[model samples]
Target chain A: MEQSMKPDGMEPRTSSLLDWFTSTIGRILISLFVPFVTFIVLWQGFLFLRDSEAPKLVIALVAIVWGVGGVAILYVVSNWLIEQLPSQWVRRLQPFVFVGPAVAILAWYLAIPTIRTFWISLFNADSSQFVGIQNYLDIFTKRFMIEAFRNNLLWMVIGTSFSVSLGLLIAVLADRSKFESIGKSLIFLPMAISFVGAGIIWNFIYEVRQAGDPQIGLLNAIWVGLGGQPQAWTALLQPWNNLFLILIMVWLQTGYGMVLFSAAIKGIPGELLEAARVDGANEIQIFFKIMIPYIMGTIITVSTTMVIFTLKIFDVVLVMTGGQFGTEVIATQFYRQYFSNRNFGLGSAIAVVLLIAVIPVMVYNLRQFSKQETF
Target chain B: MDKKIGSAKRQSRIRDFIVNGALLLICLIWTIPTLGLLVSSFRSRDDIATSGWWTIFPHREWVMTEKIVPPPADQQDRDQPMTFAGVTGTFEELREGVEQDGKRVVWIGNKRLGTVEVQEYKWITNANFTLENYENVLSGKRYQIVQGDGSVKEEQGDDLSGAFLNSLTVTIPATVIPILIAAFAAYGFAWMKFPGRKILFTLVVALLVVPLQIALVPILRDYVKLDLNGTFLAIWLAHTGFGLPLATYLLYNYISSLPRDILESAFIDGASHFTIFHSLILPLSVPALASFAIFQFLWVWNDYLVALIFVGSKPNVQVLTMRLADMVGSRGADWHLLTAGAFVSMILPLTVFFSLQRYFVRGMMAGSVKG
Candidate 1:
């Protein structure tokens, strides 16, 4: 079996220690040991350089060296070691060699921390005392948390629907128009801006001042210009401020949805639309019957993606209103609880609840992914 | 029949007009907010405060009261101090007198209670715009405070340039590191057969949606233990960890779809998996890599939550997003600075987005469509 697995070019040499060291089992063990050691040594060097009173430039240089160059070298050396192994051992171990570092990092960074978050959710603010289910109860019962849940529900439903519908509307309308690409690009431009940036832009639009003070915010400026009293838009509007906040997300994400749906719409065969038209279907009927059905998969895809986005909506809330005046959502609530309030247990619970809310969409997404791969 | 055909053509043209008009209106509405901000950033602070950005275009005469002092009390006009409103002075006279004390103060009535500069000049000026806001915000000029004694003192504020650099520092490595790691894992998931591959791949796909919020406190606790909190390295690792699942998933989709024959031929030629990946797969996956690079770049550039949690708002390490948010918190009323600062932070991502828009759209589809 060993002989069969050997490559064609070279005969196995077991005469010397160096030859033994180059053998399959020896190389596998070395491959396992060397990369780990190299990573540790380099990582330690980096930390040491960072901690020392070294010059900023020197530390930055070392960081680049360790982060990019060192990581690449580690991988290369490990791969070289794997190549020294016989074909059978190489096939068996090469996958591990390729995948092991990523898995290790993921385990360290994600899996472990996630497990730890769950564990910490059972404890109090500083994780000093174990108070199982108490934090979860508080999250479920507290007025703020309840408001957060309600607000999140509002955001998810309204924000998702508006973005998807607008996106679909624009996608359908803009198709085959003379100004199609230009219109789509204009709508899609917001996707480039960060949600935080979008919030700042929208905040200017929603800004309000004293009645006598010039109305700087566009909404108020228009309101005051039209003979109506200018009110603080985000502040005065009760439950609707959440809708206003959702508007920013809608603005930002509609572009995203439009782009995706536009691609999907363009993918629809012209023959189908022509057939529907010839059958005496009007534009609206063809849209509902043929176009909508044709892109229903895309609609679901876009909506679910936006739903996931709306579920984790944080930056916009943080920037626009700081979750004040009845605009608190789960992500901001979690932030305030953890960072401002310093309630670790409750924060973790909020996070867990968010995790719970997102899991179904994620599961659906994964199913879609696997289904796509199968084809 | 000819008349009916003509009428139908006209009707359809009208319908087309309405459809196009609605789309055009929606497009304008979508873009106007950003346009307002951009215009606001360039306008004078007073202009931003007093009028809407939309008011800039129309040519209108604005009667602005410019304070100017009378040429140091000439004996003839000593009793006639500069009036607050409608000061009797030419533009050149006001400009000349204001150049002396450099203090443009207001004059009340004919009594010279103090040396005050008051001048009223009328001019039909278009939109008053200045780059001062950008300069002030970028240079970290704090809001000045007028003390009880009428002395101005500068408060300490965040340096936008510093924060911008820190964001770049945090972002570039965070973006690159994940792509490298994920590419390898993606290659494994794509081509190499291993035990538990299916389960591990599924786990990665599942982890794609695991809220980074869930990982925050626990990882932060660990960072505290490891003394990694608030470090650039810490944020990089955190970002890499959070970004890995999606990166791996996207790259796996792209890599797995590559022609199997190329890889098989490489295998038959006795090329090691490493060599094939290095020479063939990595180069061939450039498009996929470029797409993910843009995704990760934009994600890291725009990320607020992960950066906030792992890298606290320390001056030296605070990113642009965190710093921009801080500015909003501290200087909420300073819309000029906020607008300018927001644009400054947005410039890089906007450039990336516009330049690589095609790839960005592709990345978005690859990220969402299959998922």
Candidate 2:
């Protein structure tokens, strides 16, 4: 076989496709070209199979093949292609090969839509005409949107403060206790629950039955047991019902705050607290003067995170009140405008408002992160 | 000096007790809401509607009364037997015999004739609990079936099992696709020499906080145009897109911080970038990948908005969160079903939470603290 190949190399008449592919540029082109074509073909086939009116078993088979087999093929082909390139070319192109798909998807999905939302915010309700800032003005002047802003403000102030303060208090108290893990775990348990689930749980707690019916809601039951009327807590509480909704968020977030603050507090040198004590400072004084100052950065981080979360709050409000009884926030308001009312322009405006509200917090968070990285 | 130290010690001890008590109370307050729902899910509908979940422990008693009207004077004692409420039984026999009967009887206790010629019977009964709600919810039938034998049996409500499967179907691909895509991208950002790397990475980190609400309208419109609306593929793509920012950001952070020597050695051994990623980076990055996987899994599982929009509320495709929320909306008064449904939806996340709690917490910390 070697002697026959040598003779073919000398004559060039019997040069084969395999020998051509083994050439450097040929190898590079084949490695790059074959994988991409194969990927496209496989993807198209998968999409076709997915949309076909096939039997359940057949569809399932296609799904398995696409999920497992398709990924494996793509990986193998891409690796083979990368291997064929020169070291310098490979070094330069490898990152793009790896990261390009993610970047393309993100650009198509998030970045492009964000720009479109900004553009759509300038139009009318149906987005067929450019209304130009009318929707934005309505967001400020409309009663429900104003109420949503008010509710959001309440959540920001009350939710952030309560979560941070309670978290700090728990961290300090449970820091060295025997039951610290148990207590923290119980408090942290709500973090594991989705906001929707948390809303349902709290709804059960705030449930109200008519007079003479047994109070299924624990809150109302207790209220009635204390000789008070069984009020529909979410509806009848008015502005304060906003606090009730915020309470659910605080419940879920305080654990997160506690965990981060606890780590920070533990990082605080014991000598500082002891020094404060020696200087005749009491526990409260020490906490305010020493511990709080020390963990201020963490407090800001947690608070800003909660603020961003509060601004975009949706699931809990939607689940609990459906934005009825004046409990609307920016997120739920956007949802109603977009999905329920089908007001694309107004929804886009509301979404832009939410984006504007979040940017500062995110910027601040990023700055803090960069600052910490430097340290 | 000794006296001063002794008083300080006493004060500190008191303070410790107070602190412990406060934490204990707060913990109870935090956990009771969930505890109520859990207890209610297992309770009979009547029990749940009639009493608080906390009342399950105590023996509760209530007086139940049934009215039995006697025959008028014209029909009385003329060889005409008196019947109570259309049942052909003497009042004495009815009152005494109904207690021994298995069927629900209106008259089951002592009866007395009133001035209006109506007889009333009353009895005391204790509160009872049952697993009927779970049976109904899990089976997906909401109505009670009265058998030929005159006993009531509960049929299931709308099949939560089907919705559970739908949720798994949506969640698995949504979770898996993003992680795989993000892992490759993260590898590029972290180790590979790429142009505009810093700018792209910063863009991803910045996009991390972009409210998903902003993406909904335009994406939905596009989906409509592309005829991708309400398809599983639409949701899978949307979730992957929404999830990519965080996934890429997190995996990049973890992957970039990986020890450089191992990767360098792999590169030196004539291993290609993909080979090095497959053999070294992936296995070495499992901890990070596991953490991100858990995060994405929980996020997608608990997600309602994306699913609601992309998938719509079509029963065949509705995820658990959507189904649970729908139940709450349509059957608001059915606490038994609502409580059971809430728990059913929560079951998977809670199980994942408890089992991989360490990774979940680590993920949360990595996400927030680092960001």
Off by over 4 Å in 1: A1-45, A52-65, A84-87, A366-375, B61-125, B140-157, B369-371
Over 4 Å off in model 2, which ranges? A1-18, A21-75, A85-88, A365-375, B1-9, B59-129, B140-156, B369-371
- Give the DockQ (C-alpha) for candidate 2: 0.33
Instruction: For candidate 2, give the lDDT of residue A144.
Output: 93
Best by DockQ: 1
Alpha-carbon deviation at A242 in model 1, angstroms:
1.2
lDDT of 1: 0.79
lDDT of 2 by residue, B44-120 (tens): 76677677888766443433334444445455652343454344545554544333222323434334432112233
User: lDDT (CA) for every model shown?
Assistant: 0.79, 0.77
Chain A vs. native, model 1, TM-score: 0.86
What DockQ does each listed candidate score?
0.39, 0.33
